[model samples]
Target chain A: MSQFLDISGLNARIDADGQEKEILRGVDLVIPPGEVHAIMGPNGSGKSTLSYVLAGREDYEVTSGSVSFQGKDLLEMEPEERAAAGLFLAFQSPVELPGVNNANFLRTAVNAVRRARGQEELDAVNFLKTVRAAAKELGMSPDMLKRNVNVGFSGGEKKRNEVLQMTLLQPSFAILDETDSGLDVDALRIVAEGVKRLRSPQFSALVITHHQRLLEYIVPDRIHVMAKGRIIHSGGPELAQQIDREGYTKFLAEAA
Target chain B: MSAPLAVTLEPFRKQLEGVSGQPQKTALEALHHTGLPDRRVEDWKYTSLRFLAGSVFHKPGKNYDSAKARAALAALGLAEGAVAELPRLVFVNGHFVADLSVTKGLFACSFYTADKAEPGSLVRSDREPLAALNTVLAENGVVISVPEGIDAGQVLLVSLGQADSDAVSYHPRHSVHVAKGGKLSLLSVQAGEGHYLHNPVTEVFVAAEAELRHVTLQAESDAAANLSTLYAQIEERGNYDSFVVGIGAALSRHEVHACLAESFAQVHINGVQRLAQTQHGDITSVITHAAPDCISRQTVRNVLDDRARGVFQGKVLVEQIAQKTDGYQMNQALLLSGQAEIDAKPQLEIYADDVKCSHGATVGALDDDQLFYMRSRGVPEGEARQILIDAFLEEVLELIGDETAREVCKTVIARRFPVSEEGA
Candidate 1:
């Protein structure tokens, strides 16, 4: 059977100033349908870069290899096309769009994705009704839908907003980039629950985080240890606790 | 003035002949002295009226196509919308068409002719060349006066310039007066077709305890040059709130001179300019706080695309006696193309000992992070850029108080710069 997401020999570099810095070096990873996976690594290990490359951020140049999502070349698609193809990324730092109403942005995004997926677009009234429910489920105030998108929102609120978007967009694959970094325990549970609620035989997620606390909430099916632009080791979900206790020094030394 | 400057003023100078009003003669003399300002003049430093050089702009004659005028009105939705119900003073070219106008009983409106033109005391024709030019050649205008303690709701002042083959010029002089405790909202729309010059001078007087909300939509033809000047004086506790949206004209400038003459008075000269494709738009204002405890606010935003260039020159002067004054000015520009340019000069001159004054200017392109965030959420790249552009302008557009005027400005702006294009 075809893999849900397959990244093999993927090498990506970013042009910083006058120098080219390789962020992803010959990395290979795979996630089958109906499973949640996590990547834990130290700083500068290119965890976030891997997620950005998957989401089709233009800043990174894919020097070699390929990312195939559902048997299609994902790297060839535009960012919006990837999004419409059921891929979502919960940014580590969600961008603030001032003067852009949250409700309007969500409606536009949801409608665009829906239209691309050959579904009917949601009108204003129906969209409001749908968004209000999703926002409520995420324990967010309805007023958040009226304010500017992520403008003046707390870190936890920004994280929840990402979950709200992920919920509304209904992506089959998602990448959570440190979504629980600044989130409180409640917010973490809520975020993890948001992911758990979408888990099915078709939906899969790659959670990039530093702590095992989030893994305790939505225990991943597998955990991968990434270091120096490559995933060096992989184990079962219990590997999260092992890494949390022993740290990545053991994994790095062993991989070396 | 150089010989070239004189050549530039020669067309207007010819029109000055056979005119005999004292104000007109004085304005003509001032124009001859200053000629038409060039890039050398400090006031006209960034703007050049060189487009008028050697171009004969005749006075708009009779027998203009009324059908075209009506069509322009229809384009503004004045023929059938909520704005259509408001009392509108329609000017085809520079001549007022009473048949096309509907004057109501809520406010007193009169048409003043050039033969009887009385330049108001608020404007300084000797110092400003455009005001002088307007004074010298102004043909006819509407005089609106709201009585004391009365609220005149809203009125529409529409100018439709339809120049077929000839490059015509129309100078319409308008004035507004609100008595103490009175209120009025004026929506001025400038739109038309073909190549022409629309120079209009408006004088406004806000009495003590009175309020006036004015909004101007300057959407002229792509080949036209619009040089409009406004002079307003606010008395004690009065408010002069105005917003100008510039989205048209090959070259255009909206200059405002507002004076807060008495204590507790307020004046706001807020505007936005969206230009594309070699168009040049300028918004220059000099606000004076002459009395203590007065307040002045100015915010101007510009969006330039292609090879368009935008200019913002704002000067806020607080006199020595205007202690305890409050003033704020912000000018921001968004350049969508590398070739597009914006020149912003925000000047604040305060002689007051105890005052709060702040001014800031920012020039930038669209935020790539914001664009990517929107696009990654499934919005097309073109639509994402459009949304960001709208958001950039949304902050200032919300300051417009009148719903009809605000909606009209939004409709016109969106019509000019669409929300999204297929490939844009």
Candidate 2:
């Protein structure tokens, strides 16, 4: 049928100081419903830039591109509008909103997204129950809900919070950027298991990372190697093993 | 000193000549000497009464209809909810309306200066020309004193500056005393209608080991001017907790002078002043650590909209005998519009060697990153801005020690901001 997320000839650049530096150059990607993809790249590669572009963060000029989410123009939406359209971006470093209670922030967001989808909003009690269960499953303490969002949280706790939000929002499409970098082995497993639970006929994810360890827990169906602002190679899960064994030296040389 | 000032003072001078207390005569004499503080005075540096200088504001000889007074209280929405049950002392246009107040069995007003008695100790008249005017022309006031070893219930003081007359001024003097081992909670609200000038003075005396909680909310009209002064002196082991929330008024200032006179005395002054559309608001406080082993904390927040201006001038004075004193003061502002302005001045004058005193001030717009973070989480842009603005001011509100008054402050603040989800 139709592609779930279609990114075709996506070229993006950020204005730094006085010059426009290209970050994502003619990148093309497509995933049907229910498929998970991993983007493995070295530092200075355009992996994180791609995730930001999809999220519609300001200051990035999409020189030439098209990102179609569920057959709609995703690039034309506001960040919140994008969120309302079942598109979620789990930030590499989840933002800390000081003075905003974790629970209140999530509830406001959940209600916003829910209303946009023509769904009735959850009451406080029901929202609490859902959040509590999800937080318990993610091994996050209930007090995390009482404190300010992501403020004073440990590195692992912030990552777990991202997964917690992902579980709560129940997005049809998610982009996890380096979500496992600060997490420990146990925390990584919990986060990966949380993501794995969302794998269904309608759910899809693009996990962006540098290491292959996270890929072991929630194994992706496809792994893409990116270098020098472009995804230069694509292969099956076996390709991830090859990169883990040899590193991105092969892709870096070829892309140059 | 000048012919114009004397002419403007002639009407008030004639009104004061009708009263006959020694304190009134002395204060009136001082009023003639200083003649309504102007821009030149250091204490009134940022605030200028030059506009008021031209207007001949007659003393409030206006009558108070209990119906109108009650309606004003009801409009505050305070009487509709939790504050309804509070036994309040209602003053309308500088006159106390006995019919609108509940003053019989719950708590007694020790001194009703309405009947031309009880001077309320005009302590700051020498330093403050406004206090001089208050002592000379104050028509009515409430002085509630709790005896030693008593736990008196809280009392509400509601002052409405609404009157039918043109450009009237009222000076209502209030004095509260908590004797040794006594405790008291006082919630004071000052609101007005139309163009008027409200100059109310308050003097609080906290005896050794006593406690007092004072919450003042000021919401005057855009055509009005308000200059309220509070002078508090605390004894050894006494505790003073005070919070002020100001909104509205074309020009308003709340001047506080707190003296921790004895050892182990504590004082807290936490306040918020909000203004919109060319309105000007000020929170000026001077705290003194006169004795050793005392502590004082002052935190104030200002949220200005449109072309509004906010001024925060706070000073902490520590005497040589005030060793081991601890003092902290912070004033922060959030300007929602580009045209909004804030002037902050924090000063410390300390003679003690073993004291820890610090002060800080910050002026900024609503943080862009915080706003974007909330918006990205699916909160609408308007709602996101409202949330961040509330959070910025909530930092000061949360510092209030009393729960009920803090909630009232929060409700008032939320209702004033249109985009707030809580009040919306």
Candidate 3:
């Protein structure tokens, strides 16, 4: 049987200025059920591309390879199907929808997933109660729910909002791409804890980040060092500090 | 048929043979001179009157199928709701239906049959061909007067057209007058079934310090053509606030001529059109700032799909003496399909240098990033698109100050365009 989440010989490319530029040369990674994996790499290393490819983003064309999630071919699913199958991607830069109410959007998304999973949808009263408790736990103001989705939100708030959505969506496999980059120490801790709360035997995640600060709060079961569109080395959770202090220079040399 | 009839004013003029009103006689003479406008006319550039060609629109008879009218009302959610409780003026086939109407309200209301109808003073029939057509063939109408210092709550003016095998057309002439210090809100709903033409002309006179909130919901039959014209004259400190929502018709155009005749008056002409299939919708307005300190604001939005076409033409003319006139106009369109089209023309003629006038337009499709973001969160592509569309129109709907009117428009739009069940 395939692993809980698996990627083998994955290659992807994007069209930039009418020219095809390969982003993911050959990415191979795996994570068993209930385990958290961290992929730390410098800029231009195709770290985010791996997350996008897994989320079924249409911009990137996967030339070769296979991705299996829970015994299903993940790449064959649409983005929404991926979501309904318990996959979520925390964007590096959250999009702003000017006139969509934050609370309403959250409810619609949550109910959409629930409906697909054959779960009874939550009504307005229950949804408001659940979302209110979630927001308060994230230290978010009530007014944020009334405003447009992510419009005019601060960087920290946008990140927290992403976490809010991740918490509400309750995805089985989440790919958080630099979700802690613009966050402060307190916000980073809250977001990490939000993810930690979802850690269980049924849950798995891939945390992609530049700094090791986030890993300190939500330490991973394994850490992989990626360079030039490939994961070159991996080890236990201790590898995060090694790469954090010494940087990817050693990994780049070793991969070369 | 003996030699296919030419598409001209001949059919319409033939009906005017025994028309006794002097205004009708004069309007017929004008029609003989100018004829119907084609695409060559600057105002009629984007819209075509060729839809009026083959079908000979006969004057609607007095009787109508009440069941069909009831079904139409049910479609609008007006059969039972807060809106149904309001005082209503019901007209079927252009003739007033007393049993179906409830006219007990705070205002003085009267009806005019085609022969006894007195054309209002506001229309310039010589210049506008449709207005001239309405003057000659208007069969039924409503005359509403709000007394001074009285706040008339709300009134419903409904026109439902039901045409059978023989295509029928009706021109309903309506006039609204608000005395000094009076306040009124008018919600006009136009709906119909089958092949027909609905051409209505309304004259509004707002006395000094009075207010008239007019909202029109044009949900015509898919096979019909709708041509409606409105004229409003606002005196000192008076307010003429109007909004038109167009979601139906094979071809439709809503034209408004508003004049701020005195200082400090305000006029707002805001509207939205949601068209699909091969539908065509147009909104054209001319606001004349005749006195200093008058304010004119207009915002129109269009959502088109399939091979639909949308048009917006707004002209703001500020007179030489109208200094400090604050005028703003904006038109935007969201094309949901590759074949959809939108034509926007914003004109500003300011003779006074001290006036402040601005106009802008934007056309675009739904942002892919926004769609992806929503889909990434488990919302299906179709539902995500619908959410974004509602968000796009929510900003404009919020501008409607009257709660009931806004709710009615929202209900109508939601019923007309529900969430798509299939994914993209």
Candidate 4:
């Protein structure tokens, strides 16, 4: 396989005041199948920008680069198409859809993906049963399923809801962008557990975080250090500990 | 009393001139005094019935093939009418269709055939010229009366318009009265085909301690015009609750004039209108708190697509003597197309010092963030848009206390939306 996810010479810019400002400068990275990779970076290091680009957010312009998922061009697909193609992005802050029933929203997403993947659609009763079970495993209340999607949900609840969606979608590759932020320790552990449960030879993940706090619960196979819109270092899990102990001072000095 | 008549309105004036009864003459005189309200008139500023001046609507004599009428009736999903278990009183083109009708609670043949005109017990005609015109022309209608201290289960009235090549108009005058401590729930469904104008003026009376739940739906053919008006009067401790749904017609307006005539009476005017394409809809209400401690509430929602336009003009009048009055009204519109338009006017005329009255109107397009969120979740843009629109309408539906009636309201709203599904 030509690199499960191949990103080469990725150059991106964001629009600010009718002007394009470079964010990602000639960055290159790759994640093979079944490997969990963590990208640890400080603020303004373009960690979030990379996740947003991979998720196909329209605000950012990709000046130059090629992204391949399973040998298929990923840049040409819409956000929903990317989702249907097994690319899921766990948002740091889940959107609140007032008046949209949580169960209804979840069912619509599930059925849509199933139809795209040619899987048999689940009926309402079966859907409820499955969702109830999954929700219980995540320590969620039945009322959460009855309320509107993410409306008035607490910070922890929103994070857990994101995890619930990831578990339900079961994407081949997931980009968890700071899902550990705004989450309590217990919630962080539970969310990490949810991601760990999906670990398999067929699944891989790109976890982006500013702190190494999340890597503690879900150990990563590889750790990458990013600074000033570029990955400056790559090593084993020990790199996470090193960064936690010394901070990005040494890395920034070296990159400069 | 006729206002200056245009060339088109002369015929109505002549027709009114021929009728001599005081009520009919008074109505005709008023029509003559006001002629047909044009742009100059305050109430008729947004909607112009000026076409009715030039247009001639033939009497309901052109009977069509029963099959088309049956199809129109079937498509209405009358089973969702809530009171489906109750026998339905069917009216076709302002004339009762006995073959397809069975009525319970209270029914009178005179109201259907115009064979007689009994003195109307509850007449609170507003100053609108259309109200006066309806008085002179109204012949087909229904009259229901509940005895004192009795609870009548429910009653349904269905009016179907059979398509005809020639344009026509008819006024169905419905009069209902609930005596002291009486209860009544009335469901009215108005649907039709072809180029026609359905003007229905329903007058309801609720005695002290009585309650009336009135739900009216106007889903006429896209080619037709519907101008429906409701007049309600409430006494001490009486409640007049109503919900009106406007979904069809090229030009339509659901107008209401409710007066709380006694202390402690309450009135609720909640409704929803969905219009698409070149259609135009208006929901106008004028509620008056004439007694102390009376309350009134109004909530209306509109979903517009294409070049469709919706108008809301609601006014709450708290009389100087009516202290402790509580009145509230809110109107919201969702524009689904760039060309769609909504005009909202909330007028609050409160004279009481110790009263609580509030009114608000909002107009906006589909939220961009909400749309992106749903689409990001894998819902196609069209379906996601439909979901948000549906959700936006639920807040108004929740105001409906009757479960079955709420379902009926939602069903009508849904059937009217996704307009492409119907045209395609």
The best candidate by lDDT is: 1
> Which candidate would rank higher by DockQ, 1 or 3?
1
Clashing pairs in 2: none
After superposition, candidate 3 runs with Cα above 4 Å error? B1-7, B10-13
**lDDT of each residue in A19-73, candidate 2, tens digit only:** 9999998998988789999999999889988988898788789999788999999
lDDT of 2 by residue, B254-347 (tens): 9999999999999999899888899888899999999999999999999998999899999999999999999999999989899999989898
The digit string of per-residue lDDT tens for model 1 on B243-287 reads: 999999999999999999999999999999999999999999999
Considering just chain B, what TM-score does every model have? 0.97, 0.93, 0.97, 0.92
Better model by lDDT: candidate 2 vs candidate 4: 2
- Candidate 3 lDDT over B119-163, as tens digits, reads 678998898888988898887799999999989989988989899
TM-score of 3: 0.97
Per residue, candidate 4 scores C-alpha lDDT tens digits across B1-424 of 4356655466344344456556776666666666666777888788877546555666667465577777766677664344566767788888777777766545332353344654355443437666667777877787778889888867778888875676777778888889999998877888887888888888889999999998888888898888887788999999999988888899898988889999999999998888889888989998999999998988999989899989999989999999999988999999888999988989999888999998888889888667666666666667777888888888787877777666666776676665332111
Which ten-residue region of model 4 chain B has the weakest summed lDDT? B105-114
**Which interface RMSD does candidate 4 score?**
1.3
Interface RMSD of 2: 1.3
lDDT string, candidate 3, A1-256, tens digits: 3699989999999999999999998999999999999999889989999998998889999999999999999999989999999999999999999999999999999999999999999999999999999999998999999989999999999998999999999999999999999899999998998999999999999999998889999999999998889999999999988987798888888889
Candidates 1 and 2, the one with greater TM-score:
1
- lDDT-wise, the better of 3 and 4 is 3
- State the DockQ of every prediction: 0.91, 0.62, 0.90, 0.65
Model 2's CAPRI class is medium
